[model samples]
Target: MWVCLVVSVALIVARLALRKVRGQKITHGDYWCLCAAVSIVGRLLANHFLLIYGSTRILSAERRIELLKPGFEVQASEIITGSKLVLATRSLLICVLWSLKMAVLDLLARLIMKMPYERKLLYVFWTALFLTYLASIIPVFVGCHPFKKNWQIHPYPGDCVIGNVWLFTYEVSNILTDILLMAVPFSLILSVRIPGMQRLRLLFLFSIGIFLIAVSIMRIVQGHNSRVQSAHTLWASLEILFAVIVAVTPTLYALVRNRHENTTYDKSHLSMGATARTHPGSLAEGDRYAARVWTELNDSASRTDTTSIEGILVERRYETSDVKL
Candidate 1:
């Protein structure tokens, strides 16, 4: 996750710096991605701590806990560690997931910001997501009858029935949200009359959200496996990590597209130079023009200003949703 975070931060910084040079307003989407990077770092640290403490449970009660009987034993330390891991996982997962969704969604918002109806729909989407995030997190803090029931060991005054139902519901919601986010961008793209290659790239980028849905399903299937808490934490981190990868892909693609455009421009200029050299009277003039052209190209290519490099990305012909703002 942190790897993803670092790459994203680097890209966004490059993007913002380029935009600044071009005198373009740095969009909210850039800030959203930055926030997502920070959230990824937070999740990584929390999960790292979780893995260290949770892995301590690898020892059976005999070694790690006080053995009181052949069938049953108790360890206060293990219980405390278990409680911390559970609470940490429960609380932090939502934050990581929410940040990931917001990052992806905000990018879409920037892409389609000029479309009034769609932008309003995004407002609705953000509100619903915020509400869902709250709903999902509130229960972890307040669901238990006495609150301590959340981490209480076995031998409750009565039977201690663990709630697998909520777990399944949470997984389903995660899958549903991933699907929703994936659909929005693709649905909008479908209406645009872009060239086939650009359309394919857009589809590919948005389709990455499917991986998040797959990870959510796997997480549900792996529920409550006590044998390896570290494995569980690893898999959970991957859900957000997968999103980080998808979120960074489009920005990186812009850089690639910019390079391709530069190559094309240089080739065209070289062809013009060759044509000029073909005429005897124009040879000297052509040589000077070509020299000047080469100098300009070299200067522009050497510039690290991200916006001018990626200007074509902002002006892609298929941005039917574009507004002046």
Candidate 2:
């Protein structure tokens, strides 16, 4: 328990520190991944605590078996009990929050494509993510139940209530939401004025997000039974991690490109635009433009008057045109 806890904490801390060093803002997908990582840690702690303190507390092996009477079925070790159901419920709420975050992100992306108001679109995405976070509490309470011994172990009594509803909703909503998220970003990417081949290449690169959709599909398929005990947190974690990578990779890739361009321009006599010449077999004029703009953008970044910090100017633009073809 200690080892897992320590490792999870270290991973989380490292993730945060890296983002901080890179000046990375939390996107909607990043928001959910952070939440999932925190929740997994919390769930692990709670489960270990329950194991230490609950029905099996300090009991000898002989005594443990003696406690299990005939007709009172003892489920498989991994099956969801009331406590695990509660954890599953919390996880579901996080999933819903992810869905809502994506919804707003898609809306904002649509707005950016049509209206070209990047700042306002970003603000809308921020507001939506915040509001979606608040709404997560609904599923938390609705799906989770407190730990109570002998609460619903017997199948005939049908004591289960809270978890089933959440499981169903979570699975269904996630499927739809994952597909939506995978699709929406493409709309923005494809609409970029870059040449078709370059646009296609970028589109293909971004399409890597669909792999997350595959993860979602697997999670949903496996989640149908509503037996929280059987639920696989490791598989769940994979989905969360991949989805986070989806959101984070683009930003990181853009930053790296910009940095590289800036470095090249600092050493060369050619203008930033000259760096945009295309390589063979690669599709998309946007790629070339992006290549150029990134160089110019980096050059602009290099020209910042670091000594006169008081009057420094920062020109940070997210417009598609700035992506250059």
Give the best candidate by TM-score: 1
lDDT of 1 by residue, 102-182 (tens): 767766665454333555778777886777777677666655567666555443412122334445656777777777777
Question: Which residue runs of candidate 1 sit more than 4 Å off their true CA positions?
Answer: 1-26, 55-75, 154-166, 224-227, 255-325
* lDDT for residue 186 in candidate 1, whole number 0-100: 74
lDDT of 1 at 282: 26
> What are the per-residue Cα lDDT tens digits for candidate 2 across 80-187?
253444454355446533643453363335224323344555675566455544454455454424433323332321333334454445545555555555554566
* Candidate 2 TM-score, C-alpha based: 0.52
Instruction: Give the Cα lDDT of each candidate.
Output: 0.54, 0.44
**What's the number of clashes in each of the models?**
1, 15
Q: With candidate 1 superimposed using the best TM-score fit, by how many Å does residue 78's alpha carbon deviate from the native?
A: 5.2
